[model samples]
Target chain A: MELFFQFVSNTGFYLADYRNVIMIVVGSLFLYLGTAKHYEPLLLIPIGFGILVGNVPFFKGFGLGIYESNSVLHYLYFGVVTGLYPSIVFLGLGAMTDFSSLLARPVLMLLGAAAQMGIFFTLLGALALGFLPKEAGSIAIIGGADGPTSIFLTAKLAPHLIGPIAIAAYSYMALIPVIQPPIMRLLTTRKERLIRMPELREVSKKERVIFPAVGVLLCCFLAPASIPLLGMFFFGNFLKECGAADRLAQTARTAIIDTATILLGLTVGASTQGDVFLTGKSVCIFLLGAVAFSIATASGVIFAKIMNLVLKEKINPLLGAAGVSAVPGSAREVHLVGQSEDPENYLLMHAMACNSSGVIGSAICAGILWSFMVGL
Target chain B: MYGLQAITAHNGWAMAFAGALIVFSGLVVLSFIISQLHKVLLLFEKKPVDFQNDLERPDIEPPEDKLGLSLPKQFPADIREIARLYKPLVEALGETFCLSELYEILRKNDFPHPHITLTALRESEILIPDGDGVFTWNPPTENDDNEKVEG
Candidate 1:
């Protein structure tokens, strides 16, 4: 009877705090968003479930928490901590990515570069908010809206902030459909949204094959710190475009990337314990992340409008909002918005050009931040 | 007061300007290189054939199927019969057809397998989906035309 009472007393119900309860509810919200809303299900489901697992209030000395040494979760989390998962994810992304749109319309690459205003501005915000430079740099990358890049930068510059930063980055990415349309609408007129882009010129096979090689060389020469992420990325693209390694390319994009994603998302989620995650700093990070993302989206759209003044053939400025590197998600959102304005306006391909360029641009920005902040 | 002090304590404005400049410079250089790649490849005498004109030629004969016949062999026999039945309608529709419009033509002509025929045409690379249930016919290549003449 005494033992039974002791067991009952030691249960999670007694051990759980208000913060733990809040985190678990937050996790459930993630699960709901992923499952019911179908918003980034591949990432959110694992992350949500991991949050539940992490917040269960197990004995700390029992090697149960993700941070505990010799724990299985710790072992899995090593990839995230060492930045292996993001690099591998980049490989998969490179293999699956079709850079034809970017190549066909080289000028749209500027929108991708211009959209990175969010990252730097957010960096300043984070610093002003009393974060150390490293922490600030890590926080600012959430603006780029590329989850892996955010993880990669945080792991390098501020490992302690990885959990909140990754969560914030991914939350914004999943909310692209919700968050972006308003900014796009606010920035552009109906006529501007309806402006149709000309058809993209065909990119030859030779051009496709040469791109990964030249791209790596050019990008890496400019930002050597980015070589780890960008190298794997371009190598994966080379595998796909070179025509000699179809099987390797297929495996990288499918099986390898899927495995890495599951591990990265779950470990990242599990890292966000109530004790680690429910701090004032975390709330600030989330707020700053939202601001950064909004600024990035706005900057892209506004820049496209500016560019329209110089060009003879006007571009649909809506494509510029796709420059924040949410991959096909942001591009798809741009298309949906354009379609709502003019059903015949097929901006998907042009938007994809901007979106893919955003991926490269953000990775470059992450490297720049890493170079500046890592040592300081 | 602390928050306000924190915001002003760093050289964020300078860093922001420099960072934006670097990103712009790097990508602009990349853009310039990519814009020149086609011209450079052309100089090396490895030019991609212009398919725009070839794709517009309605007078060119469609290639034979794997069975060495004039129609696609991979398609169901019923779909092939439907294609034969609606040849004039297809010619009139030009390069693209709406699935519903194609179905209407098939129904009016008393042909079967409108859905199956559409799917088969896509699989056979004769029709490319142009989104929104629209499909465009693939233009015959010079190689396809040469093969047709040889056969």
Candidate 2:
């Protein structure tokens, strides 16, 4: 009887500590948000569960291969911490992206640049609260609305702040449907939102091929620290969509990317240990992230309005909202809003161009921060 | 313990402060590069002799027989256009069923075992194999089709 009691006590099945319970509840929230609401479930579900597992008081030894030095996830996360995976993901994105919309109207890229203001502003806010500079920068990048970039940057600059930043980045990205619409409505008049853009001239295949190569060369030469991540991103994209490399494209988009995502998600989740994650600083980072994201959306829209004064042909200001790192999500939101104003309005392709530009812009922002950190 | 805590805290703060300055400098360089690239791209666009003229080509029409092109297979017009567009691939596959046949199968069933269909036809020993990498449709039992249909 005493032996049975001892076995039960030793077993980790029982919930024991308050912190464990809280973290488990937090994990369940992530799962529920992912499964029920379908909010960035791919990464959040794993991250949530990692939080639960890491917080299990009696299960300190249960590494689940995530923390194992030789594990696949650990190795993949080496790319994350070193700022490689997100950039490679960006490369795949670059390949998939069509920048013709922004090319047709070069002004939208400026909207993307303006959207990054949320990052700087949020960084200042985080710093004002006495968070370390690296942590503040990492937290601020959540405003960029790019998940992998957020994860990659946070892992490098502020490993301890990973949970809040990851959670904040994805949550805000998911809330694009919720948060951006209201701000977009408040900032732009119905007339501005409904403004019809001129038909975009079709971009040639040759130009498409040159865009990534040129973009990669330009950004890398300007900010060398951004090279590893941005270079791989553009390369992956260039390989995938370059018309001749169907096999390479198939591998990058499907097999390699899929495998990386699974490992990256799990390991990123594992890094969200409760002792490190459950802090006042983490909560503050979340609040600041929200501010950063909102500011980015507003800034993009405002910048577009400013450009409307300069350009002869009218530009739809709503598409400017897609300047955040949420990529298609923010882009789709802008497109939908435009369609609502005029059903014939097809802003999807145009919005996609700016959205992709936002991805590059955000990476450039991170690279800049990284250079500063390295004192280069 | 207090001294150690203070040192760690101080180190963390200093690192973060340094990080911000680097980020700002990096942003300045990036902005400059992007602006210059923008000017170059604009210059390239304005140069009419360059392939920039191709952007305004109105004579371009959708292909009449789109066979090999990776166009979106959304509509019957697109498929017809694909058929017209892919005339070269169709002519190249002369003796065998062409992309038109594949399109027919795909349109009907929404899927087809392309390799199986090709291999089965090849096994009947009537059609000549090109030996090149491109698979052409060559049905062996073409002569027997009338009798088989009549029966």
Candidate 3:
């Protein structure tokens, strides 16, 4: 019996360290959030499970280790850290966007520009908090609420901050349904909310075909840092709209993106090991992230209001708030809120224009950040 | 030898990791702010382009009548060009003797409306509603109500 007790005490099987137990619990929480709460589950579930598997303690009998340098996560991090995966994800995003609404009202492009104010103001705020300049920049990107762009930029400039910044961006994006409406209501009156946009005229197929190529050329020439990510993105979109490469375009948008998302999620999740997480600064980064997202949404709406004052024809100020990085869903949120107020308020196409332009705008923002970091 | 002391010792790597993440997030935020401010400042330098003038311009929007509705010649010309693309499906649906089936068949072919397809069939005296949920289509001048099966 004394020998048996010694065996149990010496054997590091199960709960060998209570910290691993806690980490497992945290990982399970992520799984619940993904499966039950359905919060970005495609990414979060794999990430959650990766965390769980990465933290599993003392499995030496299997002759395997938990997240050693040559582990599965290390290889996954290779793509994420090198900033290759997110750019491919961006290619899928560009294929999914339709910029016809923005082209119809080119002035709405200003809202896309204005919505980025959140990122800048939050940067200054992060800097004032005494963070190193590069670290502060990565933290501020959480305001954009665009996960891939945030990840791409942080991977280049501040790879260490990738986990927290990504978590912040995705978390706020999921919470947009909760976060955006209050700010939107506080700024706009019932009259403004009820303002129905006049019907948008159809864009010619010729224009649609031309828009993607021209957009890629112009943006690439202006901000070369944006080329690799934005270039593939527009190329995917151009293939889609060009009306000939349907098979290849469909495969890129659906199959390629779906595969990458799984690999990316697992990799990102595993990177958030207990040894990497559970810090005071990570909490601070999360708090700062919520602030940046709120400010960006508000700034976008305010710019639309400003535009209305200067223009004769009315635009729904709500669509402007959709300028943050969540793409069609954020824009759809604006439309849904407007639709709740008035069913006749069909702002989908208009909101889509701003939302799609945001894909370009945010990538450019990422490129600019990369350029500044590299001093290109 | 256990608990907090053990945790602190084990967590040296975590602390380093958190420090690195914080630094990276800070850099992205900084770049975003500078680039956006640059664009905003440049806006003032340009002449304020009038939204109304742009709105009034015909180049901005197509004629107002085309909202939500696709142009008539657009999908049809393309469909006829590739009618062979849908020929097998068309042959399959013709075997199903229900208006709902026919409605789906027409829609799959991108006929503008499902009702229009039924209406055209009725005007041509081809489809006769059999008082039940089903529809019987008669090839013109044929008297036999034959339930013919196609292999």
Candidate 4:
């Protein structure tokens, strides 16, 4: 009878704290958003389930928690801690991405560079709000709207902030549809939104083949700190475009990326324990991340407007908001907005140019921040 | 002057400006390289022949009628089956057709494994290769068609 009473007392129902219950609810919300709403289900499903698994009450001394040294979850988390998964994810992204749009319209690439203003501006905001330089830099990359880059920079600059920064980055990425359209509407006139771009010039096969090599050289020469991420990225692109290693490219894009994503998402979610995640700082990080994303989207739109003043052909300013590197997600949102304005208008390829450029630009920004703050 | 030290020391405004400048400059350099490289590569490429216009050209001679052609005697069962299915469509497409056009036509008709179908037709001597990946349909002879009808 005494042993039965002890077992009942030690049950999760009795041992659960308010924070644990709150985290479980938060995890459930993520699951609902992923499954019902279909917001980045590939990432959210794994992460949401991981959060639920991590939050289950366990004894302190037993090595079951993700942070515990001997735990399986902790071993899986080594990739996040060491910044390996992000680089691998970049490789897979490169294999899948087509840079022809960016190459065809080189000037649109500038919009990508301009959109990175958010990262820099948000760094200032973070510093002003009293984060240390490294922490601020890590938080600032959330503005880039690239989840892997956020985790990579945070893992390097401030490992402790990885959980919040990654969550904030990914959450905002999933919310790109919700967050970007209003800003895109407020910033541009109806006519500006309706401006139809000329068909992009065809980029030759030779140019496509040469781009990754030249890109690697140019980017790495300027900022060697970006080598790990950009180098792998270009290498993957070379495998895809070189026309000789199609099987390698296919494997990199599909199997390798899928495996990395599952591990990265699950481990990142598991890292967010009730003790680590439920804090005033985490709340502030989320707020700052939202502002950063907004600033990046607005800056891209505004910069595209500014570019129209100089160019002969007026660009649809809506394509500019795709410059935040949420990848095809932000680009798709740009297309939807443009379609709403003009049914015949197809801004997908144009927005994709900006989106692809945004990926490169943000990676460069990360390298610059890493070089200056973390000394490469 | 705000520089690397300022960024290292957590000078938010300085880092912001510097970071923006660096990102812009690096991408601009990359943009310049891509633009110039494309232009340089274009100099070496021969002007691409417009295949659609070539197909429409009146000067090219029509392929000789191949109505008497028969499937190879040693053709595999799979190849023969595929050839049988594709023969009517090949005849409907007329004498000469682009491989891609035929693939699309087969796809529109919901034909399974168009590539395999095309390969099988080729192996059965029903599709004779013309220049530039185009093919000429070589229909079975009247005797073979009549044999099939009677048998």
**Candidate 3 residues A1-376, lDDT tens each?**
9989766765556335765666678678878988998766776687678767666554444433423556555666788888888888888877776766665666666676667777766666666565655676788777777888888888988888887787678767767778998999999999899998765544556666766776776667656888878898989889889989988888889998887777777677666656666677788898999998899899889989988988899888998898776876688789898988986466777788777666667777666655555642
Q: What does DockQ come to for candidate 3? A: 0.03
Instruction: Return the lDDT, model 2, position A164.
Output: 70
The alpha-carbon deviation from the true structure for residue B38 of candidate 4, after best TM-score superposition, in angstroms, is 1.9
Candidate 2 per-residue C-alpha lDDT over A280-309 given as tens digits, one digit per residue, 9 for 90 to 100: 877888788889999989988887888789
CAPRI-wise, candidate 4 is acceptable
**Candidate 3 regions with alpha-carbon error over 4 angstroms:** A1-26, A58-67, B1-151
Residue A204, model 1, lDDT: 94
Give the C-alpha miss distance for residue A207 in model 3, angstroms.
1.1
Q: Once superposed on the true structure, which residue ranges of model 1 sit more than 4 Å away at CA?
A: B1-9, B46-89, B92-151
- Model 2 misplaced regions, further than 4 Å: A52-57, A61-79, B1-151
Number of the candidate with higher lDDT, 3 or 4: 4
What fraction of the reference structure's interface contacts does model 1 contain? 0.76
Model 3 lDDT, full chain set: 0.69
lDDT of 3 by residue, B1-151 (tens): 3333432443323332342233234323432433344355446544455555565656656544212423346334222222333334435656436777656655544555345335655665556677677766554432222322221
User: Residue A167 CA error for candidate 1 (Å)?
Assistant: 0.5
| Full candidate order by TM-score, most accurate first | 1, 4, 2, 3
Q: Per-residue lDDT of A234-301 in model 4, one digit per residue for the tens?
A: 99999999999999999999999899899999998888888788899899899999999999999999
Please give the clash total of every predicted structure, in order. 2, 24, 24, 0
> Using lDDT as the measure, what is the rank order of every candidate, best first?
1, 4, 3, 2
Model 2, C-alpha of A299: deviation from truth (Å)? 0.8
